[model samples]
Structures are given as structure tokens and as C-alpha cells.
Target: MELTLANVMGLVRQTFADPRGAAQVVLRLPMPLQARWAAVALMAVLSAVLMHLMSGLMPPAVGPDGQVLPAISPFFWAGMVGFGMVMTALLAFVVGRWRGGRGELADSVILVAWLQFIQLLIVVVQLVVLVALPVLAPIVEVGAVLIFLWLLVNFVAEMHGFRSLGMVFLGIVLTFVLAVFGMTILLMLIGVAP
Candidate 1:
């Protein structure tokens, strides 16, 4: 069956709301391979675009003519994709091993990349909503971090196994919270991101 854009968007929403369960859903589809392939492709494009947008939200780029422009740097984009791919593959191996999931490096790379795409989409939505109504900015940003941590926990389970999913979930929650604080401190020290 051909996957539609609407179906992909729904999966993206599901990924944010509940990633492990979402993974299960993806795994259970009648045509899991096709669905998975479509998801992986969509995610790659989304991550590329969203990474650029988020970078823009950070340090606003100034054009050579002194006009404000979106921060557009090939290095930054490369970092985004490279880091994402590496982490995804690593997590897939480690987590799949832990869970006895038999996830190959290539498989992990594909799934994790797609997962990041879902993650960036959520971030973009938060950024847009926060900018439109600044009062909710803090809530949205924190919420985005929580969702990521949740994904981390799910990825851990994907590798290790389901027995410790709850523990992994707790770990994700704590680590993510700590990461937020850690990242905030780093940003404050650096002046700002761009």
C-alpha cells in the first residue's frame, strides 16, 4: 500500500505523544517494510529543513549587506545530519543489543534518523507557537525536551529489551532534565546559539 503524506503526519504526531507505542504501531502495520521506508525518507527531508529553521531561531544571520537573514551555514547543517546519524546508529546498536532486538546498524540508522525528523517537527511547532504567543514559550521548550527524553528511553528499550522499559523511561526523564539544565548553562556561557 502506498503511504500518504497525511498518514506520515499522523505517525509524527503519534511519535511525539508516545514513541515506544508508536514504534510498536510501526512494527505492526500490515506492510511494515513499505511504511517504514516511507517514514525514513520523509524524516530525512524534514530533519534537513527543520535543522535549518531551528538554527535560524537561534542567532539571526546578518547578510553581507547588513540585512537580517536566516542563519544558513553548511557546517551547521552537516553537524546536524552527521550527529543525528551517528547517535541514531549508536543508540540502535546499544539498545537493540540490550533488548535482544537484533537491530542492524543500518536499520538503526534509518529508524533513528526518522525519529529525529519527528523530533524536529515537534520543535518547529513549538517554536512557531511560542513565537506567536510568547507567554507559552517556556512551556513549549520544556515540553520538547521531555518528548526527546521519552524518545531516548524508547530507543534504549529498543536495544536492550522490554523488561527494563520503565527503568529506561525513568532514566530518560532524569537525564533529559539534567541535559536541559546542562544545555541552558552552556548557552548562557556561549552568548547564544546560531
Candidate 2:
């Protein structure tokens, strides 16, 4: 089915209420690879913009010279989002297949894209709260993280057609550990670590 405004709203509601049902809907859609990538790109750009705005609201870090340090570039935020989207799809596809899942890469990509869209909504709400009541920003940030984790576990399990949520959770934990290890190695190589 075409992703009209009404359909998208319905899907979002379903995702919030029953993520597995949303995953089923995602799997049934005939979205092209290009379209899927486009959606990912759109989410990445929006996320980057929101992050940039949110960062602007924070107090700038001061250096030893008493000058405000430059904030992170927008390009960096966009790149991070792009990298995260790709890695999530890759991990989901590889780990799911290794676990004897029947899902394909396209399924993983679609599910991740949908999840990112949901996350973008959460980010928007957090941004609004941060603007209105800065003191509540920390609470909103923590709540968003918890909500995202819960949605991700269910969405990953559903996308992979896995009957065991525990297996999916374990797979995610392994992926995260490996990613951290790899990033540490990269940082060391780049002299970013002492």
C-alpha cells in the first residue's frame, strides 16, 4: 500500500500499540530499494537538523583560553545518522540470517527506516520539551532512550520472524559490544585515545 499521510499515521499508531503488527505491515509493502534508502536519508537529514537545533540550546563548552569551543558540524551529525542507519540494517540482516531467520536485507532496511521515523518523532517531542522547560530535558532524554530500546527489541524480533525475544536481545547486545570494540580500535588508530 502507498504510504499516504493517513496510512503513515495509522502505521505509527500501530507501531506504538503493536510493533510486531507494524513490522508485518512493513514486510508486506513493496517499497523499492531506492525508496527505502531515500526514506533513510530523509530521516537522517531531519535528525541532524533537530540535533543541531537542540545543541544550540545547550550552554557552549569553554576551552582553557576561555573561548567557546565550536559545536559539532551538521555534516558530522548527518554522517553519524547515515552510519547508524546502515549499521543497524547490516547487523539486523546478518544476525537475523545467522539465527535462521527467513527475512531478507530489504526487510531489515524497511524495519530500521520505520523505526528511525518513529525515533524522529520522539526527538521532535524532546526538542519541544527542552525548549519549553529546559529543566525537564534530562528526563525527556532518558524516557526517549528507554522507549527507543523497547521499540527496537520488539521491532527487531518481529522483522526477523524470531519467536524468541531473548535471542534477539542477545543478538543486539553482541552487535553493540562488537561495535564498541571496533569504534575503540578506530579511535586508537586515529590517536583520539590516549
Candidate 3:
């Protein structure tokens, strides 16, 4: 594809019309490598700043070294959004690229943001659960997270018209299981996470 402003704008427009399909194209193909690097850098910078800000929001307790605890605030939420979108964008790219595609980066960002919006819906429900239905928090939160992850991954895959839903499902399940396994192994080695 010719790299022009029109093409970029078209990509953006096409992405909006059918984001999941457009995303699959971007994620799976061997597209221009520049966007990947750009995305990763953006993700890293945002992640670092957001992590710092979010950490400040935590309810602090006395440390073993006798330091005063910290407090968690509602600041830096946009940064937190940056952090989340970057993560989903990476996931979209990896899963998309793995199956062979050369899609645009902007589309990937859109998918990331769209999925993030869905997650926000879940968060709203979780918040309501906390306030009005405290006993349901764990169930709602965990179920919503798992369902959202699968749905987002699948939706992103569907966008690119590459990896099948089954493949995405297997990929996600395998990825999750392996992550757990790897963490378990590492923790076992270090005497953690039983």
C-alpha cells in the first residue's frame, strides 16, 4: 500500500467502520515495523508514568523499614488509560502479526480503546456491586474480566480477518495457562505463589 496521507486517513476511516476487522489486518501482517516500535515506546512511557501515579493511589501501610504509608487518589486517570490502551494495542499487534498481516497502527489503537471502553463498562458494574451488592463483587469482577478479555481478543482478531475465533480462544487460553505455569514455576523456584 502506498504510504500517503490519504492512505493513512483511509485506514483510520476504514478502521472505524469495522474496527475489529481492520485491527486483524494490522495485527497479523508483516506491516511496517516503525509503527510497532512507536507503539511499544508509547506504551512503555505511558505505563511507567501511570504506574507511578496509580501507586500513589494505594492505601499505604507501614513498611518493614518504618516508613509512612501512602494514599491512593483519583489523579492521573488519563495516564492509567494510556497504560491500559498500550497493553491492549500490544496484544492486538502480537496476535494479529502472528497470523500474518500488515495493518495500520491507528486501527490497533482504536481496537485497544474500544476494548478498554467495554472494560470500563465492566468496571462500572463492579463499582455498583461494591456499593449496592458487596457480596457480588468478586463474582462480577472476575467473571467480567475473563469474559471481557476473551471478547476483546476475539473482536480484535475478527477485525483483521485473520486468526479464527477458535485460534484466538486457544491462543488466549494457552497464553493465560502458560503465564500461570511460568509464574508458578518461577515462584516455586523462589519460594513464592503456592
Best to worst by TM-score, what's the order? Answer: 2, 1, 3
Better of 1 and 2 by TM-score: 2
Models 1 onward score TM values of 0.61, 0.92, 0.53
**Scored by Cα lDDT, where does model 2 land?**
0.86
Q: Rank the candidates by lDDT, best first.
A: 2, 1, 3
Worst ten in a row by lDDT for model 1: 27-36
lDDT of 1 by residue, 98-183 (tens): 54566555555555655677677787787787568767878888887776767766855654445577776765456557656876
Candidate 3, residue 161: the lDDT equals 58
Worst 10 residues of 2 by lDDT: 159-168
Q: What is the number of residue pairs that collide in model 3? A: 20
Give a tens-digit lDDT track for model 3, residues 29-138.
44455665455445444444544553553446687899976643334554555655675566566666676744455567645654554455556566666668778878
Evaluate candidate 1 by giving its C-alpha RMSD to the native, one decimal: 6.9
Worst 10 residues of 3 by lDDT: 71-80
- What C-alpha lDDT do the candidate models reach, one value each? 0.64, 0.86, 0.59
Instruction: Please state every model's RMSD to the true fold in angstroms.
Output: 6.9, 1.7, 7.9
